[model samples]
Target: MTQDTLNILHLGLGSFHRAHQAMYLNRLIEAGETGWQLAGGNLRPDMADTIAALERQHGEYTLETVTPAGERSYERIRSIRRIVPWDAELAGLIALGAEPSTRILSFTVTEAGYYLDERNELDLRYADLASDLAGTSRSTIYGALAVILAERRRRNAGPVTLLSCDNLRANGERFRHGFLAFLRQRGESELLHWVEANTTSPCSMVDRITPRPTPDVAERVKAATGWDDGAAVMGERFTQWVIEDRFCNGRPAWEEVGAEMVASVHPYEEAKIRILNASHSCIAWAGTLVGYRYIHEGALDPEIRRMAHDYVTDDVIPCLTPSPLDLSAYRDTVLDRFSNPHIRDTNQRVAADGFAKIPGFIAPTIRERLADGHGANSVALLPALFFAFLERWHRGELPFEYQDQGMDPDLAHGFFHAADPLLAFCQDLTLWGPLAGDRQLAHAIFGAYARVQHFLGRSPA
Candidate 1:
């Protein structure tokens, strides 16, 4: 594929995008596919270093994959045709989206990056969301897309699909909902009509354990490739992308390159989100409190792994049972993958966006279990661990920084100061969702909190 043949505009050019989606596209290109070269951009400056490094390398990078047996391999990825640098204005990204050839706008802007409420509305409380309300292109996916899609509408660019590659349940539909809500907030009925008419949002489920790059990654890349790669990414050997076979413009024959193009991504999505993703965070938060730096260490610990295993086998599996996938095997595979020593997946990385992770990944099992009149004890343990981790942060005992897009420091501090922090944390509607006000749910969390405290050999707070 030539650079001029770019047909995919990817937003949020970060680690996961580089390792997962871009790698899939590169595989297709290697097999003689055409007309889908990727153009990457970031709305926020958080990855300025990555953007600059990719630009310096002319959009080529290395991918290091480590297997469960500690086997490491490297691949040179050249799927990205160009990267729109982070400037004060988002004009370049808007123009890329407006190009008629750019039939797809895919993104890996994390779960929290969506900035949506429980109602799936655009969250304007964010500064960029507020600024974008005034019609200026800036940061945040909503603001950025509001500007880009408006330009596409004005230019009458051919219909394009907004493929969301985040760890979001109903990701494509969620993005579509947030986009329409943002447009409505902008009060652009004509543009809104254009977007509604021209866009397709197909839900998908993406899985990979691509942790943040460590120094050893660069060293391995240099030794293996005879050159240094600053923007290298390291991921697990196993990867999957189950996309709903619905598209507006057109989609690559991704299935030809190991992606699953299915009629409904619902079953696959539910299993992955509730099982793999939720258990990942459970280990991460629990691992952090136990002074473990990496997820594998926690996965190795008997207490930690038991919490995750029970959470999956006891709670998540029953809720998603009698399905096509083998829930037991999937549960075991996820735990085994989490225990991969070579990956060195950091607790901080997995535990960063707990506020978003809870609603998207953990809470569904709880909600389903509660709705069925079954106790959600196993699932309740996750948030209990997170709240305990938050307490450590509150007391400055946490060795690493805790970054949460939706966390309110004042509200979080109140948890530590409350007469019963576990009950207070359990009652936070934003985290526990529909079960926030349920006393039974609070009671379950209290029991989970006691388990976590017992694991840590600490007195109950």
Candidate 2:
């Protein structure tokens, strides 16, 4: 394929995609590969400026990989052929999706973009669905996809693949469910049928710790390349992407470039979500409570590190399905990654969207443990940390501003004020859900929070 004809549209032009997917694509291009180039779509309005900067720079940016020993930077990232702002460029994105040359439509739109509800199901209640239903010029990734799929159905645009690179478990299935639900909600069952029959959503697990670049890192990149890179990304040296080989419109031989396209991505996704991600959140909340800034600082604290290690090995791993690989070794590597001194991954970054993330990353294991006749006494510490954070939120002790998502500030405050009554409150089957209402688990979580209060010396007034 010629340069102009090569097409791949990536949603969510975030740092992680820059370091992971874009980096992998760069490797492919350097090895003389063809028929693959990226066109990024930034969903957020503020990101339009970054997209313009990258486009002006000919889609080149710096990728800095920070290891414990030192840092390694890559300057040329020519795989990205164009940048399209999601709102202003919706027509372009839809056109690319409808193009015969466009085979892969990949997304790293984070967990929120999937519009998942409390049960981790497809959340059609999202406002974007209503907008799309009304035939408005709404420009959500989901909205754009709905429009593109509708056009594809009309044109008989052949089969296409949708690859989800988010942290959601069974990501492809989740995407398919969301897409079909959107179509059905819009009364477009014909389009839904076409999508169900022709489209493929491949499950994938992508791992990397790419933090938004700091000003110092930005200055370094500018000095090295003589170009002002506002969108430079900083990450750890480790990167992995495991995908299931289920694609409708064909895919690049990504497996040749160190991507593992397995027959099943369940094991890989489960392993990463339960182990790496769960541990990361555990450290994020617990470490932040103890006044640690970066993950490395928390890892260096013996008490925090031991707590994280114990939580992973004793509680989290026991509830998981047995893996073919050495999980212990994997745990060790994760700990090393967290302890990478050069990477300043902040607690607040990982700790964001806890309400949405914990249900997937932490709650599944909690449920599994409870089902297996195992008391959640050890696991209770995780929720206790969350409760402590909630208590902090109630007291306005948190340094950064956070948008409250569906969580009632009044309810959170009441929980903190009635710490003595928390055990009974937690027993409220509605708020805690069925899992937390289990007497044994509730008692354990209550006890753990009591301990936390004792350590902190009095609840927030």
Candidate 3:
């Protein structure tokens, strides 16, 4: 640690960050790339207890990983050198972002946190987003980054990279646009000018099945590593990060530590988002409807597995053909990752954000297929699965409490209690975009919904 050390100030301090991005930095440091380090924190107090525990341990935590074969391994992750405490004002995070030494400021906020509409514009209907637009708080990503970049500009901090490690397709480009739109709406022309010249948000695709830490994870860590680590996290052995390599400031030697620094992240992201993420939602929704609690159960079930397999094999792979990677192999690998029982990825976790997942993960394939004059029958099952899952939540029958950032309770209830719930769902512009009112889309989804009802042993109403 010296004046020469550079930093990556990360925004989200969740399990995915702890097990994925932070681990990459740790590997680089272990390989003797000592010039770069991580200073991680959160924008909100959602994980105050985890942050406090991380600070107590000086930002060191144990990561437990398991393979599909049931073999387990543990590694001590010491990449996060500083754990910035959460504050309502985000004062400490803003100061770190304004530092020229912080070459890259990355974030892992969930996909729903962006609050972008189908048109890629900022959706101010959200209370947090509206409050941020009114300058009442710095809670959302755009709001937080606006103030950070403004302060950095006032202090004359040099150019830095704004990296996004989320599941959104073309995440970096999408975020850059949404962020600039936020500034334009805020009437910060001078600050926007500085941001346009000073920051680069390169698209990146990150993958790792990092499950929410259960009490068993900590007990296992204590048994295996002899450390009482409250900050311990667990994930699948497979991990990946493909970046667009457009950093404005200098970056770490990440390529030396198994990360792919590509000229473009388009192909990689398309495969990951469509095949892995979309299928993940499909399984989660289908699994939850059929009384399954874990993702592995759905991935292992013959009928549920076929639903996901058919969606990728029938709809997605066709659209993504002529790809750099083997689409079929990639699809199989993703399903195998989901079937790892030790990860215990919950249906509740994966099934929580359908409102966001529909537009982001599932709808693109439907749009492409419909544009090519093909019916979206296979892809329709995904939204149908979601509809059945939503019905359970509406009836207060879900085994666990559902959490959706984009869902409106009254709106969802209206959908279920409407004359035709499926039609009402299809007409939600936020979920389907231009395809919202298409008769073909409606027909396909209705048929799929009936099929879902039969699968769940209930007759369609």
Candidate 4:
């Protein structure tokens, strides 16, 4: 293979990429496809340990899978050609993107990583945005992306595709919108024009239940393969990637590896978001309130599992009708995956980002239910559980450190201190998105909140 084969540069080198995208790319290579190699790195220093471990292993790692019926399997993934070192100034990242051979830059940065505000525009008020505006490199996704685009423009790098693999709806469009606004904020009209003409952002829907790796994964790998792997990651056997058929440059033979390249990813996107992502968060929050540590535990619990099923059946499925996949089967499959006891999916991991999740995962469904004048009982349960969880965080009662990029501790603390805590919670415009001002939403939330309270009264949390 020629040097040009190593062309895809991926951001956010987390476990999900190893088990999902990189794995798909590896499959293409195995199928005799050439001229495509995965180069990856984290934008921030937070995951330096994993990167360092990858360096020791020469960018190869083990992926362990636990089936629904307790079968375990392992495989070595060798698709990532290099780990681009983390640099505070993002010079290395910019260099990677500026290379002529780099045709597609993909990312798995979390939902909150993109500094898009309520209107899905670049949020100028975000502290990192201010820092990036002040010329600090790599402060946020916008910052790193700005530098990369500018360098690519200067180098006259041909058209490139920025593929978003995040869970947010219409993620690619949102990235382009926020990125153009960011360039406008920087007053780089030339770069902005270059970006518009030279780049394409394709929305994608990616799925796999990859939990944070605990010691058990490594132990299992060692016992099975007799190789001590420091960078091993694990996931459920199920994986899917549905991509919108939009790319400025060519792409890997991903379809050969089970990825669906289609006319539009909207139906798949909406189904996964409303059903899998939303109900996952529901089980996470509800499980936390009831002292469950793992997702399967909650999925097995009668009340917690019932809440998730009702949330999907009563409102989410209806909200996402007329889709490509059978909604009912998809819902059942999601529960089956969640109930995979071997996965050990933690409530804390799923519940950590409540502040970032409400708008995309929960609020949209609630807004639709209220707008249609339908009973929002199942949908409203999400925010009600969030309110309870936040109160626990405020009281220092949570078992783990709740990590929310968008929530402020002082402001969160003030929620319970306020005379009308429910009103205080509902008034945060950023949290609920467009539905923040809808009095109907606030009323529905309160009604649901009362039910959660009354249920807790009997359940003994």
Which is the leading candidate under lDDT? Answer: 3
- Please, what are the lDDT tens digits per residue for candidate 2 over residues 1-461? 25346577887787888899988888888887866888777655656666777877778888877677776665567888877755654676777677777778888877766776665555555565566657774456567788776776677767788888899889899878877776777788788888888889989999999776788778877777776787788889888999899988777778888999899988778878888887887777777787777888877766667766776787777765477667778888998899987898888888776666666677777777778877666566777787787667777887666543434456556665674646644554323556655776777777777766664563321
Name the lDDT value of residue 147 in candidate 3. 88
Clash count of each predicted structure: 0, 0, 0, 1
**1 or 3, greater by lDDT:** 3
- The models' CA-based lDDT, in order, is 0.86, 0.74, 0.91, 0.87
Predicted model with the maximum TM-score: 3
Question: Could you tell me which residue pairs clash in candidate 4?
Answer: 5-35
Output the better candidate (2/4) by lDDT.
4
Pitting candidate 3 against candidate 4, the one with the higher lDDT is: 3
* CA lDDT for candidate 3: 0.91
Residue 309, candidate 2: Cα error in Å is 0.7
Looking at model 4, report the run of 10 residues with the lowest lDDT sum: 1-10
Q: Lowest lDDT 10-mer window, candidate 1?
A: 452-461
Please list the residue runs of candidate 2 whose C-alpha ends up more than 4 Å from where it truly belongs after superposition.
Answer: 1-4, 124-129, 137-139, 403-433, 454-461
Ranking by TM-score: 3, 4, 1, 2
